[model samples]
Target: MRARRTPEPYLWLLFSGGGVVAALLLPVLVLIFGVLAPLGVIEPPPAARVRALLDPLLVRLALAAVVGLCLFHAAHRIRFTVEEMTRGGRLDVVLAPLCYGAALTGTVIAVLVLF
Candidate 1:
C-alpha cells in the first residue's frame, strides 16, 4: 500500500522560514521603527513617504508574507511548547488545528489589510 502524505514536513518548512524571517527582519524593523523613531534617535519617515513605500504591489505582498510566516512560526512554537510543557502525548490531536487555524486566520487578515 502507498503511504499517505503527511503535512508535518511542510509545516516545519513554514516554521523554519518564519523563524528565519522573524529573526532577520523583525529586530531591525523594531529597532528603526519602534525604538529609534519613537525615542528620536532617528527621524521617522514622513506619513506620505511611508504611504509611497507601501504603494507598490510587491511591497504589500512582501509585508503580507512576512506577517503570515511569522504568525505560522508563532503558532508552531506555541503548539509544540505547550504540548511539551504539559508532557501530554495526546495534545497534538487538539493543538495542531487550533494553532494552524489561528495562523491561517491571521494570514487572511493580513492579506485583506494589505490589499
Candidate 2:
C-alpha cells in the first residue's frame, strides 16, 4: 500500500493557528481601538504617532499576519458550518474552496495594503 497524502492537515493547521491568533489578539485590539479609544476611556494616539508605530516593516508583517489569520479563522468556521448545514454533501466540494479562497484573497489584499 502507498501512503496517501491529503491537504486536510494543512487546512486544519491554518484553522488552529488562526483560532489561537484570533483568541489571543483580536479581543485586545477590539477593546482598545474599538471601545476604549472611541469612548474616550483611553485617549487615542495622534495620527503621527499611529503612523510612526506602523512605520516599520516588521510591524506591517505582524499586522498582515493578524489580519490574514483572523480571516482564515472565520473562513474555517464558516466552511464547517456550511458543510454541517448541507450534511457534508456535494456542497462541501464547492464550499471548501470558496471559503478558503475568500480567506486567501483577503490575506493577499492585506499583504498588498500593508506592504
Candidate 3:
C-alpha cells in the first residue's frame, strides 16, 4: 500500500501562524487605529508621516504579512465552523478550496495594495 499524504498539517500550520499574528498584533493595531486615534484619545499621525512610514520596504512587507495571515486565520476558522454546522456533509469537498482560495485572493490583494 502507498502512503497517503494529507494537506491537513500544512493547513493547521497556517492556521496556527495566523492565530499568533492576529493575537499579538491585531489587538494593538485596533486599539491604536480603531479606538484611541478615532476617539481622539491619541493624536493620529499626519497623512504624510503615515505615508513616510509605509514607504520603507520592510514596513510594507510587515503590513502585508499581518494582513495576509489574518485573512488566512479568518478563513480557517470559518471553514471549520461551516464544516461543523453541516456535519461534514456533501459540502466537505468544496469548503476547503473555497475557504483557502478566498484567503489567497485576499493575500494577493493585500500585497498589491501594500506595495
lDDT of each: 0.95, 0.89, 0.90
lDDT of 2 at 33: 87
lDDT for predicted candidate 1 compared with the true structure: 0.95
Error of 3 at 13 (Å): 0.9
Error of 3 at 32 (Å): 0.8
Off by over 4 Å in 3: 1-3
lDDT of 2 by residue, 1-115 (tens): 8889978888888889999999999898999889999999998988998899899999999999988888888998898888888688578788989999999999999999877
lDDT of 1 by residue, 7-65 (tens): 98999999999999999999999999999999999888999999999999999999999
RMSD of each: 2.1, 2.1, 1.9
TM-score of each: 0.89, 0.88, 0.89
What is the C-alpha lDDT profile of model 3 across 20-68, one tens digit per residue?
A: 9999998988998899999999999789988998999999999998888
Candidate 1 vs 2: which has more TM-score: 1
